[model samples]
Target: MMWRRRHIFDPFYELKRMEEWMNDLMGEMQTAGGLLLPESTGKEVAPISRVPSIDLIDKGDTLVLRADVPGVDKSDISVNMKDDMIEISAERKGEEEVKEEGYIRRERHYAKYYRAVPLPASVDKDAITAKFENGVLEVTMPKVAAEEVKKIEVK
Candidate 1:
C-alpha cells in the first residue's frame, strides 16, 4: 500500500477563501451596477452610489484638487471646507421614457457622490476658490505661510 501524506487544517483558510469570494462578488456587482431587486411595479432595478475619482496636487504655496463628476449639474454639487479638511458632494438625477408601438417604458435613476480630503498643511480657508467645468471640479486652496524659526545659540 502506498503511504498517504497527512493534511494539516488551517484555521484562517476558510476565512481567507470567504474574503476572496466576497471581494470578487463585490467587484462584479460594482461593475454590473449591483444586484437587481424587483420593484413594486414588477421592474428590476439596481441602486448605485458612485465614488468620484479625484487628484490632489501640491503647487508649492497652494493645493489644487480636481474631481470627476460627470452627468452632474453644477448647482447640485456642494463643496465645504472646515479646519484642514474639505468635503465634496454631488447628486445626479435622470429620467428616461421610451414609447414603442404598443408599450411605454419609463425609468428613473439617482446617484450620489461624496468625498472628503484632509490637507497636509494649514490652508487659508477664507481664500479658497472652486470652479466646475466640463464635468470636472477644481478646488484651489492657498497654504498658510510658515512662521520663521529663529535660531537661538546655547551658552
Candidate 2:
C-alpha cells in the first residue's frame, strides 16, 4: 500500500506580514523630523549637482524624461548620453553669510548632484532637446524608428 500525504496551510505567514507592517510604521515615525536624524560624520552629503527625481513618460514618438532638479542653476546643468543612459549633472552653492543673528534653526542647505536615468524607448540622440528653468531640467529624446533599429547576429 502507498502512503498518503496531507497538505497543511501554514499560519505563520500572516504573523510575518503583520511584523513587516509594524516595522514600516515605526520607521516612518522615526524620520518625521530632525529629531529622528542619525548621527552624522560631520561630513555633508555631496549634492549630486542636479539629481532630478524624474518621471519617464512616453509621448507618441518621443520619450519625455522630466526630472525634479529644484534649486539647480540652469548654467550648471548638463545632459549627456552614455551608452543606453542619459546623465544630468548640476551644482548649487548656498549663500555665504547670514546678515542678522538669532536665526536659531536653518536647514535649507545646498550642494552639487548628478542623476542618470535609462531611456525606456529607443531614442534619436541627435534630435534630443533639453530645457532648464525655475530649477527644473527637462530632456526630450525622440524615439528611434523601428526601421532605424539594428540588431546584431551572434556567432
Candidate 3:
C-alpha cells in the first residue's frame, strides 16, 4: 500500500486561502466597477467622496437623527422627509486663500455628503423639525399614531 500524508489545522494554509479569496473578490469588484476604492497601486479611484457620521435613535413617540457636519455652513445643509424616509444632504465649500510672503504650505478641504435614513415607524412629515448647532445637525420626527385594532368575528 502507498503511504498517505494528511495535514490538518495548518494556520498558514488557512491564511493563504483567505488571502486568495479576498483577491478574487477584489478582482471581480474591479471588473464590475462596483467599488471605487484605490487598488493595490497608488492610482486614485473616484466615486463617493465622503460619508458623514450619523446617529439614529428611536424613541417611543419620536425618532431622532443626528449628523456630524463640521466646517459646513448651516445654509448648505438640506433635509427632506418623504413617507418613512429622510434624506440629508450637505456641501462644504473651500474658501479662497491669500498667499503671504514665505508661505510654506496651505491645505483646502471640501466634501459633499448625502444619506437617506428609513424610520422604523411612520412619522408625521409636516411635524418634523431640524436644528443645527456647533456643527451638529439634529432632526426630530414625531411618530404617527397607530390605528386602533378592531375585533372581527370568525365564520
TM-score top scorer: 1
List the candidates' TM-scores in order.
0.66, 0.56, 0.63
lDDT by residue for model 1 over 45-143, one digit each (tens)?
345555677889999999999998988999999999977899988999999999999999999988877777888988998899999999999999999
lDDT of 3 at 140: 93
Judged by TM-score relative to the true structure, which candidate is superior, 2 or 3? 3
- For 1-155, candidate 3 gives per-residue lDDT tens digits of 98545554778778999999999987787677563544532233334334567888988899999988777899999998877788888888785666888774556766776667777888888899999999999999999898889999999
* Weakest lDDT window of 10 consecutive positions for candidate 1: 36-45
**Sorted by TM-score, highest first, which candidate order results?**
1, 3, 2
**Model 1 TM-score relative to the real fold:** 0.66
Better of 1 and 2 by TM-score: 1
Query: What does candidate 3 score in Cα RMSD to the true structure?
Result: 6.7
Give me candidate 3's TM-score against the actual structure: 0.63
Tens digit of lDDT per residue, candidate 2, span 40-60? 322233322223467788989
**Residue 28, candidate 1: how far off, in angstroms?**
20
Residue-level error in angstroms, candidate 2, position 129: 0.3
lDDT of 1 at 65: 96
Ranking by lDDT: 1, 3, 2
